[model samples]
Target: MTTEEQTAVHAAMVAAGADRRPGGRTRTFHALLEGWGVEVAGVEEGYAWCGPEFDNDISCRSTLADVWPLLPPRVRSARQPRLDELDERFRAATIEWPGRGDEEQWWMWRIPRLLVIEPGDPYEGGWPAGWTMMPFPKPDSVRVIT
Candidate 1:
């Protein structure tokens, strides 16, 4: 994340009293952010995002949902509604498709899904070879995927 973004996240966490909370709660919040592809560090200086640029991915929906109730009312009121709106749009653009045979279902979003292939992976021979493209479902409203 950019220094500005890291500062912003750190400020938000501090404003939410993350540093004052029990260690477990702070750790849980840190883990959630990390799972969202954010690099978290500086626990003693208060939590900060030290990762690559923040993409504000759909994964943030779960993070917000899980942490909403734990935040101070002021923080929740300041941020949750806007995040909820964005999450709704993301959900509308996403489809949960059942997997073939015994595999579990997975979510497919309207945007292109990035697949990170390791050097020895079977699909590493060519880019886009391993991808399964799907047509987006017809939206009932103009707001979907807008």
Candidate 2:
């Protein structure tokens, strides 16, 4: 990973509230990535750790898919099996969500339903229609409602 990418990863980790001291979340995630033959210092591993922490389960999968093209062929080959296993597990655990309207189908982990709201909608107060909002960081484009 380039210095900029590594810095981004670290920043993401901090933004996600990961403990970065010894025996912290960063170390644990790096250890798991290392076992998958990913370089512990690489952007791939850093992103693999930060994505899920900073966002959600599907975000992790999507982030890895986004980064896959940047990996070398040999690294891709080495990581494919593990990634496939994770994909299978995620698929097995996921269920289709129909709450986000008919035009957009979202598949999420088999937990309580979550709502994702885009920006520019008017808001007044007290849980839009009584759905409790989760305390997630809202980016400029979207807010995750859990």
Candidate 3:
């Protein structure tokens, strides 16, 4: 992950209030990222896409806010700056998919998605291998990768 991207993921993790411990779910997610060459230091129920010069973290089970109460008061306070930093760095990537807000997302594993890169950030390796490619309305839109 690039420095900016790493910061974004770390910030997002803090913001999501993800529990810092590794469990079965976290291990599964970590292995997946590792196979993709993404450096994963922590594991949780969510998945992260981090690689050399690549930056993005996606969580399916939790976001910082979802698990806020689970975090210690000190940790919560420390995360404010990271959260604040993320507000400016990250932007929602519009994705056209069925049941965005509903529980019926076509790609069930992509929930709690986070796009660490900006709208115009240059990315290489384009969605990794085996990702279903579809035309997106805009560069800022999230493409459905089956």
Candidate 4:
């Protein structure tokens, strides 16, 4: 990724409190793992450490698991870090995000797993609103196009 793209993503991560020292420095998922005290360095073994249940669940797919090693181990484990570890918030995007109905389904964007960031209350029928990349966002969550 370009430095500009990295800065933008890191800025968003910082704004979301996922990453703190978010200026000029390079940002990658490995950096997050470093903060977690996981020895991710020299892990050229690819997804071997990811193990079996990595993405076996039907809700998740093998293709998604392809990016597993690229993400931080904590994110890979999908859990909260120790108090001394980085103060980052993670939701299953389904288990943690707000939704309704007997359905275990959540709709973000992916076809199988719909854990996307929609506007307003989920019960109110927020959805995959149309959007295109832009320089800035509007004030209202619905009207603001990314």
Candidate 5:
């Protein structure tokens, strides 16, 4: 975490009265970020991407409002910004999949079963030899990693 993020975290803790007495969830999240070499946090659940930075302090399922207060200046926005060319007005805000096409999304969503990310190529590694190439799933649940 950058100095800014650290400060934000501290302020959030104080404001929320988070228990930061060591070995807590917040500490754990910080440890993960340290281990992952995430320098610039990106697209947090609440805050917009603070420009391709790494963040372990927040995750998906986090309410946009609750974490909004802790967001750094870089990501704070008065209105939610439209990412890429996603037209929220024309598209349903959420999508679900049963590994099959849904008629409801045929015209509204860029849909069907989507492979969220296609790696440049599949990875082939075993433990310490190529750990960085491991197929890692980023934090997805609402629970904070820290």
Candidate 6:
């Protein structure tokens, strides 16, 4: 990732209150998410470390929105339309951006699929109806200070 992108991720970590001690960081981070109306399905090993239950289940689109400006110019340009396409399908759906790739293309978009909804391939086969995929920095792409 570019230096600016890295900075953006770090800034997000701080904004999420992840700058605290290990135990507190998780608490503080989750609290931050709660303040933003994000539903915590469970913490998982992924880009943000916290996996949101659904697109609208969490109102974290704004939180993830913070990282957009810092992405490489080409990536930002390419990803915007993909985001729009998914949003059109699922109104008010939160984006679960998986992060950018080393190559020129962007990949990995997701939203948690609750039992109420059917699960399917995130790509190729297409997501289940009412599902929306958002964007987020990759886990390995950003150096988040824990």
Candidate 1, after superposition: displacement of residue 15 in Å? 13
Q: Give the per-residue Cα lDDT of candidate 3 at 74.
A: 57
Instruction: Please report, in order, the local distance difference test score of every candidate based on alpha carbons.
Output: 0.37, 0.38, 0.35, 0.30, 0.30, 0.38
Error of 6 at 62 (Å): 2.9
Tell me the tens digit of each residue's lDDT in model 1 across 34-122: 44332111111222221121123334434445455665555556655655554444434332332322332121223322233344544
Off by over 4 Å in 5: 1-5, 17-23, 27-60, 75-146
Better of 3 and 4 by TM-score: 3
Of candidates 4 and 1, the better by TM-score: 1
Task: Give candidate 6 regions above 4 Å deviation.
Answer: 12-56, 69-75, 92-146
* Candidate 4 ranges with C-alpha deviation above 4 Å: 21-29, 34-146
Instruction: Estimate candidate 5's alpha-carbon lDDT, on a 0 to 1 scale.
Output: 0.30
Q: How many residue pairs clash in each candidate?
A: 2, 0, 6, 5, 8, 5
For candidate 5, write residues 12-87 as lDDT tens digits: 5455434232455453223322322221122212222121121222221122334446656554442235221222
Q: How do all models score by TM-score?
A: 0.32, 0.35, 0.29, 0.21, 0.24, 0.29
Better structure of 1 and 5 per TM-score:
1
Q: Please, what are the lDDT tens digits per residue for candidate 2 over residues 1-146?
A: 55665555445445544425345535322333333333211222222222233234344444454445554455567767887765444334332232432322132322222233344433444323223343342222222332
Candidate 2 Cα outliers beyond 4 Å, as residue runs: 1-58, 99-146
Ordered by lDDT, highest first, the candidates read 6, 2, 1, 3, 5, 4
Residue 29 of model 3, lDDT score: 22
C-alpha positional error of residue 24 in candidate 1 after TM-score superposition, expressed in Å:
18
Task: Please give, for residues 24-143, the per-residue lDDT of candidate 4 as tens digits.
Answer: 564444444444232211111111211122123221222222334344444445533431232121122112222233343321111111323333522223322322221233213222
Question: Candidate 2, clashing residue pairs?
Answer: none
Deviation in Å, model 3, residue 28 alpha carbon: 17
Clashing pairs in 6: 95-134, 96-134, 97-134, 97-135, 97-136
